[model samples]
Target: MTASVANDDGPQGLRRGAVGFGGVLFQSITFMAPAIATALSIPLGISYAGGATPLAVILALVACLIAANSIGQLSTHLPSAGSFYTFVSHGIHPKVGFLVAWGFLLGVIVGGPFLALQMGFVVAGTLNAEWGWSNDTWWIWTVLVCVLVFALGYRGITASTRAGLVLGAFEILVFVGISVTLIFQAGSDNTLQVFGTHYANNPDYQGFSGVIAASVFTILAFIGFEQAAPIAEEAHEPRRTVPRAILVSCLAIGAFYILNTYASAVAFGPAKMIGFTADDSNPWQNILARDAWGGIGFLLVFLALVNSIIANQNAANNSSTRTMFAMGRIRLLPPEFGRLNPFGSPMLALCAQLAVSLAVALFLGFHYDPVTGFGLTATILVDIFAPMYILLNVACLMYFWRFRRDEFNVVRHGVLPILGALAFVPAFFAGAGIPAFSFITALPKPLWYAGPIAGIWMVIGVIYLIVLNGRDPDRILETKRVFDEA
Candidate 1:
C-alpha cells in the first residue's frame, strides 16, 4: 500500500498518526452536523410523515447502518485518503473508480456551499428573530466562516479533528439534554404509537407511504457518517479505528435522531404534527425550548446550530481536501492540488474549496436567497450521494469476492451489501420525482434543477475520464495506491 514517488519533490503524504479513534469518531459526528439536522430536519420529516417521523428515522437509521457496514468493511482493507475512490478503484474497475472520484468530489464540492449557506441562514434567522437584526447580514457571516474553515483546515488534520471533537461534543450534549427534557415534559402525551405506521398522517402520502416518503429526507441526516473513512490515513490504527468510528457514529447519531423525533411528535401532538413546519414564524422547537428553559434555552439552541455548522464545515473540509490531495497525488487532478504547505496541509486544495464555496454561496444567495440556495445544493448532494452509496455497496461485494475470497462471508459481503444497495432504491426514486411510485411527492419546482445539475456534472466527469484514458489508459489505476497504509 506504499505510495509510489515519481520524483524528489513529490507529495510528502498526510501526517500519519495525527489523530486517534476519538478524533476520527468525532470527525464523522461533526461532519454529520447533528444539531443542525435535529433543529431543521425533524420538522421537514414531520411535515411528510406526521407523528411517524420517528419510524421513518428508524428505517433510515437501519439503512444507513447497513450501508455503514459495507463502508466499514472496505475501510478495514483500504484505509486511504481517497476513501470511496480507493474502494471502488480496486474493488470494482479503475475507470469506475475515476467516475466515483469525480462524482464523490462533486458531492464534497457542493457540500461546501450547502453547509455555508445553512450557517449563514441559521445565524441570520436567529439574529433576526431574537434581536430584530437584519437577515441581509447572512452573506457577511458566510464569507467570514468560509475563511475560518480554510484557516483551521490549513493548520493541519490534528487541529481540525481536535476542534471538531470539542464542538461536536458540546452540540451533541446540548441537543440530547433538550431532547430528553422535551420527552419527559410531554408527560401523558408521550406514547410508543409514534413509531407505528398508523401515525403517519401526511394527506398526500398517507400511512406507510408517508413514512416511506419521509425516509427520503430522513436519510439526509446520515450523510456524513462515513466521513471518517476519508481521513483514515491520518488516523492511528486506521484499519481498526476507521471502521469502529463509522459504525459508532452511525449508531450514536441514529439514536439521537430517534430521541429528538419522538420528543417532537409527542410534544407537538401526534395527529397535528403535520403542522410542524406550517408556521415558520413560530418554530415549535424554539417555543418549546423557551418555555422549558426560559430565554437562555432559545439562545443555547441557536448557539448549538452555529457551533454545529462550524464543526461540520471543519470536518467536511478535512475530508474533501484530503481526497483532493490523494487524487492529485495520483495525477487524476493537477499536481498542485497534492502539495502540502509548511504546516502539513493540502494548501492549494483548501484554498480552492473555500474560494469555490464562497463564490457559489454568494452567487446563488444573491440570485435567490440563502434558504433557497441551501436547498438547491442539498438536493444536488443527495442526488450524487444516493447513487454513489449504491456503487460503494457493489464495490464492497466485488472487492471481497474478487481479491479476498478466502475471507469473504456471504452474509457480510453478499447479502448485506445487496440489502444496503436495495435500501436506497425507494428513497432515490422519491427524491428524484421520477413518477415511478404514486405515493412519492415530486420535488418543488424551484429545486427541479438539482437533477440536471448532478447529471451534467457526472457527464463532464465521464468526458474528462475518456480524454484522460485516451492519453494514458493506466493513469486511472493509480487511484488504488494507498500512501501510509497501516
Candidate 2:
C-alpha cells in the first residue's frame, strides 16, 4: 500500500509510495471494464454497418494504439496525478492544460453518473429476472450502488482497486467463456466476413457518417485505460510501470473488443448479424446467450452483468476522486478539494463526485427513460472526452518533438500521433452533432456541448485563480513552479 503525501496544513499533494505492478494492472483492467464492452459494444457497432461493426472496433483500436504509444512515451518522462492534463500542461501551454483538465473533469463528472446509471440498469434487470421483483426506477438501484461506491472510494484507492480486480477478473472469465463457446459453435463457418469490405458495403448503412458515429461509441470501451496514469504517483515505479500499464491495457482492451465482436459476428452469421435490431435490450448479451450459451445462458449473462456494473462503479469512483484531487492541486479548484481523509483518501472529492452522480441519477430517474438518460450521458462523455483525447494526441506529438528527439521516429511519435489526431477529430464533431441532431428530432438534448461547457468552466477556473492571485500571489507562483518542475 502506498502512503499519501503528507500535509502540514492546506492541501496535501498526492502520496508517493509504491504500488506494485499487479495493483497497477488491476486498476487498469478495472478502468477498462471488459463486461461493459461485451454488453453494449456489439449492438452499437452493428447498428452502424452490421457485420462490419467488428472492423470499426479494430479501426478504433488502431487509432487508440497510436495515441497510447504517445501517452506511454509521455508517462515515462513525467508521470503525474493529472494524466493528460498534466501532460498537456508540461508539454504544451497552461491554457491548453486548463482546457484539457476542465474537459476531462467534465467528462468524468457527467460520465461517472451515466456509468452508474448503466450499473443500475444492469443490476435492476438482473434482479428483476432472478427474484421477480420489479424496480421501475433505476434511480433506486443507482442510489444504492452510489452509496456502496462512496463508502469504498472514501476508504482509499487500494480497496477500490482490489474490488475492481475481482470484478474485472470475473468479467474476463465470462467474456472468455462466451467467446470460446461461440467460436466452437461457429466451427469452419467462422470466416473473415466480419472484417471484410463486403460487410461495410450496405446501401442502407449510414456509410462514412454511420461508421464515424458508431466509432465514437465504440471508442468509449477504451476511454478509461489512461486513467491509471493519474494514480501513477501511487505506483511502485511511476515512470516504468505507468507507461507499461497503459500500453498493455490498451492492447488488451483492443484485442478483447475485436475478438468478442468477431465471435458475435461468427455466431450469428455475418449476414444475419447485420439485421439484429437495437430494440432488444442488452443486444450483445442476447446474441451471446441465444446463440452461444443456450441452456444456462440467462444465468451466465446475469452474473456477467452484475460484475460489469460493479466494475464500472469501481472505475467511476476511482477516476472521479483522482481527477478532483488533480484539479485541486493545480489551484483550478479550492484547496479543500485536495484534502484527504484520515484513511489517505480524498474524502471531500469523493463526496463531491457522489453528490453530482446522485443528482444526475435522480433527475433522469424522475424525468426520462433509462435508455434516454443513458444516451444523454453518453453524448456528454463523447462531447467532453473526445476533444481531450484529441488534445492529448496533439500533446503526445509535442512531447516527442520537445523532449524525445533522439527516440522520435516519424512512424512512432510523428505519424502515429497525426493519425490518432485524425481518427479522433471526426469523433469530436460527431459527438458534438449528436445533441444538435437529437434536438432537431424533438428529443431532449444532452446538457449542452461539453467543449463550450468546459470552456465556460475554464473561464470560471481562471476567475478563481485570479482571485487567489489577488489574495496570495505566492500560492499561484508556487503552483506554477510545481507544474514547471513536473
Candidate 3:
C-alpha cells in the first residue's frame, strides 16, 4: 500500500481482518440503517406533507445516488483512509479539503455522545416499562455504552465491522418483520393511497416549499449511506466494494423506508397521522404499538429502538476515530494521534473520540432532563455534521467534473448534483432556521443547528490551520502536495 506520512509512521494500515463483502454490507446496514431515525422518518415524512414523504425520499434518493456515483468515481481512483476529505481535497482544492476533514471530524465526535445518549433513552424507557426500574440515572448507562464502543473501536476496524454486522443484521430482521406485519394488516387500499399523490392534495400545505420542508427531515432516514466511503480503506476491493456497497445500501434503505413509511401512513390513516405530533414521546413507536402489534408489538419496537441506539453509537465511534486518525496522519494534529495499537487500531484517536463524548454526556446529563439532554446533544451533533453532508454532495459534483471527465455529462454530474443541492440546501437552511424559530416561539430549542454551528466549527478549523501553517510552513506544503499530485 502506498503510504502518505508527514512525521512518524502513521497508524498501521487496516489490519488484515476477516471482514468481507457480507461484513461490510452488514456494517453499512446496521450502523447506518437501524436507528430510530429510520423508524421515525415515517412520521417525520407525514409531518412534512402527509403523504409526500415517500416522494421526498425518492427525490432525495435520486439526488444522493448521483452524488454517490460521483463519490464512487473518486473511490475507484483513490481509495484512502481519509474518505471524503481526502477525495475532496484531491479533487478540488486543499483548503476545501481541510474544511471537509474538520467538518466531518466534528460531526463524528459530537455524534458519538448523541448516539450514546439516545441509546440511554431507549434503555431507560425499556427497563422502566419492563422491570420497573428508575430511569433517573440513564446517563451512567449511556456512558458505559460509549465506553464499550470506545473499547471495541480501539481493538481495530475488523472488530468494529464485525460488531456492526451482527447488530445491523438483527435490526434489519426486526424492522422487516414489523414492516411486513404492518403491511399485511393495512392491506392494499391503504398502501396505494399512502404511496399515491392524494395525500399531498391538502389545502394546508399549499406549495412545494411545505413539501420540501417535510421531505428534508425524511431525507435524514438515508444519512448513513455515506458511511461506506469513510471506511473504504478496510475493504478488500475498494474500487468495486465501496461503490457497490454505497449503491446497494442506498437502494435497499430507500426501498425499505418507502415501504415502511407507506405502511405507517396506511395503518394510521391520513387524519390520524396528521394528529400525531413531535410532542408525543416516542411518537412512531407509540403509533406502531397502538395500531399494529398491541402490547407485544410495543415491546418489540422498544427493544429495536434500544438496539438501534447501540448500533448508531458503534458506527459513530468507527467513523470518528478513523477521521481523527486520518487528520493525525496528515500532520494536522499531534503525531501521537496517528499511532496505532498493536492490533492496528487508532487507539489515541479512538480515545480522543471517547473523551469528547464523555464530556458532552456529562454536560447534557447534569443540565437537563434525560430526553431533553440527549435530544439537544444529538441535534447539535447532527447540525454540525449536516453541512458537510451537503458539502459532500457538492464535492461529488465537483469530483466527477474533474476526474471522471468522460462520464461528466450534465445529467449525471451537473443536474443530479443540482437536485441534491436543491434538496439539501433548503433543508440546511431549515435546520438552521428551526433553532431560531424555536427560540422566538419559545419552543424548546434544538441543541444545535446545522448551518451556524458547522460554520463556526469550520472557522475554528481555518484558524487552527493558519496557526499550524505559521508554525510549520514546510509541513503545510507537504500536506498540500498529498492532494496536488492527483
Top model by lDDT, which number?
1
Compared to the true structure, candidate 3 yields what TM-score? 0.88
Which runs in model 3 stand beyond 4 Å of their true positions? 1-11, 16-18, 129-131, 201-203, 206-209, 277-280, 287-294, 434-452, 473-486
Which residue pairs overlap in candidate 3's backbone?
Answer: 30-168, 48-214
List TM-scores for all candidates, in order.
0.96, 0.89, 0.88
Q: What's the lDDT for candidate 3? A: 0.66
Task: Write the residue-wise lDDT of candidate 1 on 46-129 in tens digits.
Answer: 778998999999999999998999999999989999998889998899899899999988877788999899988888888888
Global CA lDDT computed for model 2 = 0.71
Ranking of all candidate structures by their lDDT, best first: 1, 2, 3
Alpha-carbon error at 94 in model 3, in Å?
0.4
| Residue 451, candidate 1: C-alpha displacement in angstroms | 1.0
Give lDDT per model, in order: 0.86, 0.71, 0.66
Model 1, stretches more than 4 Å misplaced? 1-8, 281-285
True lDDT of residue 188, candidate 3: 58
Error of 3 at 479 (Å): 5.4
Any runs in candidate 2 off by more than 4 Å, and if so which? 1-7, 129-132, 206-214, 434-486
Candidate 2 lDDT, 389-462, residue by residue in tens? 77777887887788778877888778888888778776666555644432112223544443465567768768
Rank candidates by TM-score, best first.
1, 2, 3
Candidate closest to the true structure, highest TM-score? 1
Pairs of residues clashing in candidate 1: none
